[model samples]
Target: MTTQKIAVLGPGSWGTALSQVLNDNGHEIRLWGHMQAQIDEINNNHTNSHYFKDIVLDEKIEATTDLKEALDGVDAVLFVVPTKVTRLVAKQVAETLDHKVVVMHASKGLEPETHERLSTILEEEIPADLRSEIVVVSGPSHAEETIVRDLTLITAASKDEETAKYVQGLFSNHYFRLYTNKDIIGVETAGALKNIIAVGAGALHGLGYGDNAKAAIIARGLAEITRLGVKMGANPLTYSGLSGVGDLIVTGTSIHSRNWRAGDALGRGEKLEDIEANMGMVIEGISTTKVAYELAQELNVYMPITQAIYSVIYEGKDIKEAILSTMTGQLKTEDEF
Candidate 1:
């Protein structure tokens, strides 16, 4: 296999884990981040202690604080930054790139202000002449497990089938696999919306709710996600795939999910500001809840679960009250959109 030079623009948990995957696939990787100390740690110690405390990164995975140096002569760029900073980083990437390369983003969340997907932000910031069709890689995979080389499967969605296939080959290994999908909208929507449900699930768990309640949240949450995604031009079946129900289940149930953790804290009476300050990571669901709530209203989609979570986080509503209201809302059929 020919070794490809790839730049991973983010040294956060996901970025660091994916750099290992590319390194394992015999690729030269330049892991970029804004933190100078983190870069030093990855280069000298071969570990990002801030994100992954126990795992040692591969020695070949070079870490850099310089964007231009990271982008120089790379075949593709994988962005794993948080949604809040995607546009800023992508703009920097656009200014630094000297040649065209396949651009892929693994970040999941709609832009808080614009309610736009990360790929859209990338396309707007990174000129068409400087990159190929944007690819979105998302699914049930979590960085905590992925960093340890656990078995994982995810989707690579793009408008261009060849590009999706290219990404599939680039990241696949014995433990890490990629499936190609053409429905970029569904893949991205599912990826972003699931985090909100995960938050709700965690809140349910924290509020002393049992398995049945969590299960209800997951099921109804998928219905809500599917409703909005379909309204946004996503394929309904995509919700049944890895990026949809699969991701929702793992994230909503797992302890490793930042969104879940945040919701748990909120359910336990912690303030949103306190949760954000202490987590040391971006809980994409918090911002996503606001965006999804607004978008659902604008699109005239019924998403009671999303509204409940949004009320708790944004409106300062009591978690128990918000959840209770959603549960006792007007009667409807299970299949109602």
Candidate 2:
């Protein structure tokens, strides 16, 4: 493979680990972070204390706070910032990189209120000529596990098969595996929407439910995802791939998931303000819940789990009440519509 200059625009755990993986594979990586402390640590100390602590960064992995420095001379860019800041960061970076650079984003969430997917948001912020070059990297891998070089898998989806293959080659390593998927819409949607269901699963676990309930919810929750995804131009089978069921399993079951942890706190009767303050990490499920609820409303899609979680989080409803309301509302055959 040709050596390429790769720029990653986030300094969080996932971003740092992914940058490290690319650096390990002999690619030149330019990592961008908003915090001076993170930039200083990466450049001066070869470490990111705030994210991947104790993991020594490769010399090929250069860190920068300046957007231009990160974008300059980069053949491709990874937009790994949080969902809320995706558009803002994309707009700033677009100003420096030309339209030919392949822009890939790992952030997974629909735009709240607008209900637009992250790819749509990226396209809106960047020039129209570069829209088709956008790519999304998603799957079940957690950043913490990835930093340790554990075996991991993810999907690279793009409008062009060649672009997807290129990103796959760039990211695949000894412990990191990449699969190519052409259904970008379904992959992105499943990746975003699964977080909402994960919140529900965590809330159920917090309420003392066992594995049986969690398994049932995950199954039904995926049905909801598949229904909406197909309606939005995604292939139904894509949701069965790494970006779909794979992501849902990890996010819903792992304690490392910010959304699941946040939902657990909420289930225990904690306020959003207090929970967020204590966690200090982006609970993407919060933002995704807003977008998922809005999309459900606009599309008239029946997302009971998403609706229940949204009620508890944004509508000030009691978690127990929401759970009961869903459970006791109706009963039907297992496969009945």
Point to the candidate with the largest TM-score. Answer: 1
Q: Which stretches of candidate 1 lie over 4 Å from their true place?
A: none
* Residue 172 lDDT (model 1): 98
lDDT of each: 0.94, 0.86
TM-score of each: 0.99, 0.96
- Which 10 consecutive positions of candidate 2 have the poorest summed lDDT? 328-337
In model 1, pairs of residues that clash are none
TM match of model 2 to true structure: 0.96
State the lDDT at 236 in candidate 2: 85
lDDT, model 1, position 167: 95
Weakest lDDT window of 10 consecutive positions for candidate 1 = 200-209
